[model samples]
Target chain A: MSEGEIIIRAEGLTKVYRRTSGGKGFLGLFRRRTEEVRGLTDAGFEIRRGEVVGLLGPNGAGKSTTVKLLTGILTADGGACGVMGRTPWLERRKIAADIGAVFGQRMQLWWDVPVLDSFRLLRDIYSVPEARWKARLDELTDALELGGILQVPMRQLSLGQRMRAELCGSLLHEPSILFLDEPTIGLDAVSKLRLRDFLRAENRERGTTILLTTHDMADMLALCPRVLVLGRGRLLYDGGLDALLRRYDTEHTLRCVFDGGAEPEGLPPSVGVRREGEAWTLTFAPAEIPVGEVLAKLLAAGPVRELTLKEQDTDRLVARMYADLKLT
Target chain B: MNIRAYRTAFAVHARQVSRYRGAALGGMVTQAFFGVMLVALYEALAGEGDLLRETATYVWLQQIFFRAFFSTGGEIYEQIMSGSVCYSLLRPVDLHLWCVCREMAAKIVGVTMRLLPMILIQFVLPESWRMLPPDSPVAFVRFALSLLTGFLVIAQVNMITAAVTMRTLDNKGFSGLINLVMMILAGNIVPLTLAPERLQAVLRWQPFAQMLDAPIRMWLHAGPAGEWALSFGVQLAWLAGLTVFSRCLWGRGIRRIELQGG
Candidate 1:
């Protein structure tokens, strides 16, 4: 891809925070205070234009700090990064105008006012034109299914509902880039699915470049085609979610059902079988032998009527990946 | 800090503030109730206004200034102590300018709705003293200058305290200490002239009076207008100096910021 295709470019980016030691050096307490800390160490990644990139990691993996750096909240100490052809720290206003962010832990909405009022306030903050603001509001409301609760105060809304509203608030200006740091944290399953759908539609329809950071692997599988993995303030891997699944596709479990047959026999080392009258369960590590090969052997062994192969989940794949990275 | 950006910040903050309807009412009632109580205490101690050297009118104006100073102080300090400062930092706006613009707008509204009404009620509605005293140009100018000075000084003090707070979670205690010291030295507890001669001499030279003392003096015509303006001049000096110091402290302070578990 050319330079214009890269919406975000970060190289050897790092942020180091130190702890302050109060005056107690040399004599007993006759010196100025100093601090000791290392918030982030050597992190880097690139996000292409109009791609929904998932930043998956555990808590305190420098995900938020990275977002802050990209959004110009914190200046990077080492290395360099560019967002939309401009240095974020130097051109914060321009960067701000182009980006939208929904920090999961905090609500930017006014607690006392109705959701609509906070939307209006954000309209001004992002300096969205009246026509654009109205258009985006309509679009977001329809997309997020926020029509019922638009007039309600933010504090009155449920966590799922509020998260939806927060997304709306962030995108009021129709930013080309969107940063969602755990947008669906603490949401119910149904709400999570709703959010996942909305995010997918938004990315597909508007082609907004999205960087979604979450601990929920379901979110990654549901929305993002590409994933950027961060572990201990370092980029562990950056590729499609399927790539991670393939990297560690060691085991594949199969549920097989036979028609009018006795228990199976002579199951291979690659497969473990448990008989349950008509249905038999088989667990095998596919890395040693392909899952298809194992299924063929099983079909020959039993009068197989039904066979199901449980696909490797991205969540488990990432979990194993993080363990391999020694990040958990 | 981008000046143009803060205009939007101000609007957002105002909307944020308005959503806390209970806070607006509570703030107004708290200020007015405290003002009335303080005035009553002043009257009781002065024995029908003859104990203090200043006239009833002068004391009344002083009471109003005292009320305004503490009320705004507590509000800003609360914002600092609570990790609510995070809200401003995460936004697209500059933290300093956003805070200043928000504060300026809120203070103007607060003075109009809460402070002015209380002063008028005490001086006019129930009719305790002159509704509008005969005022001089210098007193007016000095008073206006003092308000500006007060705003800058208090904001800077708040910023500096908040800067220190970035490194220390318990800096609220330090903020409390500063508040107490400033209130006493700035003569909000009593006119500096009425305090011990030695104490008055020392307190008169400090930054507190620019926060309140000189302005009250100018408002009451207790001192020459030039003297009052000089007090503001000293305050303006402190405001500029403190602001510069605050920003310097901010640079070092933010570098050391280790956001504790929220």
Candidate 2:
């Protein structure tokens, strides 16, 4: 396949879940009924080969449903979806061979066996050649820092270690597409960074298509340039993260520590300042007042011992977008 | 189907079962104790006769084959409840076939671990308590064949149960009900011969009896070669029919499966 090929395409994808209500007791069965819960409604996006795309949303925002439909774990109730030019649900097995998936909450490894054993089993399941398996395993182990825990049983490993091993297992076959559903969920900071870096390297070196779903904005900033935002079964935004932030005009925070107890004066009306001890935090909207003007005014007010500008936090930016769009 | 994937699945299950040697040993001891108790109960009721001997052998065999063939329903229930069964569907291999291979491997490992010690213990007991070997080499071969076919039928049944569980997303009391019914109908609790003649005739024709009773009876040379041939034919037919039925059910159920916990 050619690089930058449109590997994932979905148009007006929709899923409606009919959930049973109140069937607890024997009498309740007679009163049981079905409720139609819309999971995904007209959600559409396209991902090209070698692109690392992040799928971000709040709880019950149809992010998981979108991933499931693409992965063929669930059939869409309406619309069309194709992975590598094949219908995912209809030709699930055929598409499965070319895609690797890791669901953070659900493990694909054997619980009681050593991590290596699970890797070997996956190699066989994917029918990877011996040489290729060895090469890939070595690469992943090094990248994910799995050397110390390779022989440990999965039940014995910590969640972070197990997640790293799971990543290795999923990549053993060198699939063209990788689906990571909250891969860094519950991981420690170091493990999360390692995972993000490994994924970025994998995408960069192999040109593998990746669709990642995560609640951590840091993960999105570090790994994905393009993002699909879902909310209440609708695609609210699909574009670059930087563009989304700019479109929302998120507020930036400036923390200033002065040499003495001198306070800043003549602050712009758009700037909101809070002080605790010697540290003064200035929050302002860049669209209303220029950042340079805010800084020059602060410098004129006092001899700044230290100054740090925290760009609009991606989390808050996305949160504001969700609020403005009424997606939360 | 991917042969390599199926073989890998089988190997993984085999290793998993082997890792729990303590549990396997514990199960063997428990089954052996139950077998001895049943033998005594049958001897007290039936007196010193061929019926006692046959029933004693049946009891011993039942303990080994019960978990090996018919007890995989719990495994299916667990996979569905845990939502890990999605992996099976995502693989390129046939999901039912993969489950069959994995479960068969577990059962084989379980039977291998328990069969020898149970048989040895039975032999060390009094002659009346000991299980008699197959009547002839042909009977032994036929018994082995029947056991293989029996496993297929049981696997199909388990697959159907798993499909239903996935579709409904609730398996409470289903396993218990199915186990109780299978125990009585498959002749694991009491031999079909001990039942009323009409009832025995009807039960003998059922798919449940084909899983255990037909195989055990054929091994004991309970009927003529023509009857054995008929039993084998019936068992094969059930296997084929159950296979198709379970596959259809699974295909339909998977599309509607809303996997819990992502």
Q: Say which candidate scores most in TM-score.
A: 2
The candidate 2 chain A region of ten consecutive residues with least summed lDDT is A1-10
Candidate 2 regions exceeding 4 Å error are A1-3, A23-31, A257-261, A277-279, B73-76, B82-84, B222-224, B258-262
Candidate 2, residue A29: CA error in Å?
4.1
- How high a TM-score does candidate 2 get? 0.93
Residue A93 alpha-carbon offset, candidate 1, angstroms: 3.9
Q: Calculate DockQ per candidate and list them.
A: 0.27, 0.50
Error of 2 at B188 (Å): 1.9
The top-ranked prediction according to lDDT is 2
The Cα local distance difference test for each model comes to 0.70, 0.83
Query: Model 2, clash count?
Result: 0
Give the winner by DockQ. Answer: 2
lDDT measured at residue A270 in model 1 versus the true structure, 0 to 100 = 62
In model 1, pairs of residues that clash are A18-A37, A19-A35, A19-A36, A19-A37, A20-A35, A21-A34
* Candidate 1, A261-296: lDDT as tens digits: 745566676677777767788776777777777766
Across all candidates, the chain A TM-score values are: 0.88, 0.93
